[model samples]
Target: MWEETSAVDKYGASPTGESFEPGRQRQVCTRYKRKGKRHRRQTGGATRTVMALDSLPSRVVLLYDEWLKLADPRTEDWPLMASPIAQTLIVIAYIYFVTTLGPRLMENRKPFDLKNTMVVYNFSIVGFSIYMIYEYLMSGWANGYSYGCDLVDYSSNPLAVRMAWTCWLYYFSKFIEMLDTIFFVLRKKTSQVTFLHVFHHSIMPFTWWFGVKFSAGGMGTFHAMLNCCVHVLMYSYYAVCAMGPAYQKYLWWKKYMTTIQLVQFVMVTVHIGQFIFMKDCPYKFPVLLYIVGLYGLIFLVLFLNFWYHAYTKGKRLPKVAQKSKALQNGNGVHHSNGVAKEATNGIFYGTTNKVANGFHHGNGIHNKEK
Candidate 1:
């Protein structure tokens, strides 16, 4: 049996009977057998050989091509006269114009409500976020950059046009984000539009511009990937809150959101550090180093300040309690529905006096009449 098996090969053809050496015969027979097995698969062609264009939705490819034309930033007829520095300056000027002009124009109007428009807006942001994550996870495993940041290093692995379209959507979303401040101004929520908010909003569009410009396929895809995940949760929370009472408790992890943002910055910094310290890397590091450094410091300061104000200082509000007591006494309890009342303390105080007084009115609230 062993002699027969050795004499025969992957193909039914007897190797010893063939003119070629048994090893060479076996190699050819194995290949022939493999091809025959592949033909049995339900799909016709090898998946890797399939063109992405064949599977891509027609509208997406069209839009992607259009966006490429607009966003390419490469042209001899209209050459890039100014460096990225000029573009950065232009963005700064635009920020200044909006910050100054927007307030005055919107002064009379009420702040924008997160009710109807915010729901749509957040849904869109989160939807794009999901697409970004999907693309990132898919490409990361396949050994390719998800976003256009791949040019920083050449990837032998090919990506689909759909992946390219998804990345373009992520890129354009940065432009649409300018409306975040517009909404803030319309609602007279200018106080919320801090320098951190404006600066972040301003820089990101240009940062992504350069991201696509220099490193059109590389480690930077992780930045978009991470941001998308964060935005998914963040905007979903916003959308839920906008829906009135539907899912108000959905964002129970609001405190942790800031922590996650801080962690993201730390991770980005560390990743950029690797690029800087490494002796051998395929990417150009100087540009990425500047971006990562600037981004890290800015986010660290902004996040720490936000954490302090939102949690730390907020916890130390005995002064607010004292003021509440003062206002309570100053209002003076009144009789209503056969009951009396007394003064109390802060925001967290109870309605004990309301129970005694039967019905009472204070601080824009009406208690039940006894």
Candidate 2:
């Protein structure tokens, strides 16, 4: 019976003895299971997962549009809140607690195992950035808006929830950046926290808050793109450095990191200025320009001062040493020519050989190679 079963279906088998399952039948459909048809689910967070483009419900899109209008009401109708002074103080206090107090508590603690943490963090942020980059690219070609528009109206699109989630993550990163200082404060590497250090830490998160708050137009994206790229390199450098001394020399790009930061500000200022000047595009302009302009000027001044103090002074110190070296090479010793000539001329012939010997002795060049 078992042998016969191999040769027959419920009805019968082909003459060649080919058989099929009794419940099975031939189907000619060419389509394979589509990628998202099953087991596809929301990811990232509740707001992000359910509201994703793949499974976005119509109601969510409507709600998102409503939210965008609320978030970015027309320029004239914005309700006045606290004065800038009050708001600024509140924001500064908030940063002091989040960036400073938290880090101080963790001071004297061993550096966190940044390797594993950074790996997970980078992978997630990089994936999120890639998603946004793709969204921007497609939106540019097919959706009519370019990079800036994508960012400004980002909250209104179907995928706005995901962008919001990622934007929040980037905002939180500024807080994480405070750890750069904590490591300084803790490790007793106080020299690292120069004025540039505190200024960068203190200002950036606030800049981002206003950026997201005001809808900062689309021109703000150059800031995001440059930041993402810098973080990619910066965190990777940190990850490698955490491994050991092997990476110290490999970090020659540290110099370039500062350069990149300066360049990022320049581009940001120019982009914001263009929006302010042109008075074009989907999002508001002059508002972002004013905010970015102030921030950019602060950064420019602080960073240029830092560059001068760190590198310019550094270069000058070496040049000073080189000049000293040249002077030493000109004379065998550091003694003045007058002292040498007086001593030698008074003691010796006061002529050709005496002067020559005096000069050689003064220069500290014992050898006759010169």
Candidate 3:
């Protein structure tokens, strides 16, 4: 017994010769209990965090539902205005094609000869623009519109309904105009697909969706009408270019198109700006007026920049013309190759080449290579 007691003391017995196993076991159990309590607290916190995260999506969906309720009931059943998803998808697909897939596909493929198609397409847009212009004029601008503080006629009046239809048609025309980019891709004129080009094309339809959805006809239609007028001249120019080089004489007014675009934005900005000073204009959606005004201002700045770089800097001249000018100056420096190389650099870099090769402007105008 003494030997066994000695062995126990050597291992874990207290100095008083008492075995420490029971006390040690108690300490170990206490440590485990404390650990278990801490684990429970951590697990509870984790569960709460997970639950909050799970509810986030539900909250977002609820917010979206509330937003949709604010949309115009009249346009709720319209084709693309019913939901934003269709238009969003269309814009996404357009970006993808023009930026990535279209270019890669056309890498090895030859450019399509679309002269005839372009002629028909341009003329069709001209005709459509004419029709829209007439509708806009008769419906409001010419009928009895004050041209300032014109409210949306939501009533079922014949002219109001006609304006609404015209607005929808105008909205739809934005999508149709997207084909301009598609043609560029198909023709392997990918160089014309500048950020401005794609951004303008994509953003127009998306923004117009809301415009037509909320305020179909009113002062909102002013820009649309002006845009159609611009399109009339722009597409007619494109149609003439598609006809052949024999008709080049008709294009002497090409630079004026940019001027006209600048004028259009100026008018839009001034026209939409009227709402700011008006006392009691009951435009159903005053928010849209501000948006259109800002839009006009932004495009006005962009086009002014374009005009400065394109015309003021003498970059709007044709390559052949530029080379001839260089030759005539006795500079003995041939810039045709250099200009060509610079034009391929990027947007706004060698804008002359861009403007020369029928670059599509954001305002739906195309300048064919001279």
Number of the predicted model whose lDDT against the real structure is largest: 3
Candidate 3 residue pairs in clash (backbone atoms < 3 Å): 358-367
- In terms of TM-score, which candidate is stronger, 1 or 3? 3
Which 10-residue span in candidate 3 carries the lowest summed lDDT?
Answer: 337-346
Clashes of 1: 14
TM-score for all models, in order of appearance: 0.56, 0.48, 0.77
Q: Encode model 3's per-residue lDDT on 233-264: one tens digit a residue.
A: 87887777777767766667764666787899
lDDT, candidate 2, at 340:
20
| Local lDDT at 280 for model 2 | 48
Model 1 local distance difference test score: 0.53
Q: Per-residue alpha-carbon lDDT of model 2 for 240-322, expressed as tens digits?
A: 44444454555555436556656766766666566655544555544665776667666656556545644576422233334
Worst 10 residues of 1 by lDDT: 356-365
User: Each prediction's Cα lDDT score?
Assistant: 0.53, 0.45, 0.75
User: What TM-score should be assigned to candidate 3?
Assistant: 0.77
Model 2 TM-score?
Answer: 0.48
How many residue pairs in model 3 have overlapping backbones? 1
Local error of candidate 3 at residue 19 (angstroms): 18
**Alpha-carbon runs more than 4 Å astray in model 3:** 1-44, 282-284, 309-366
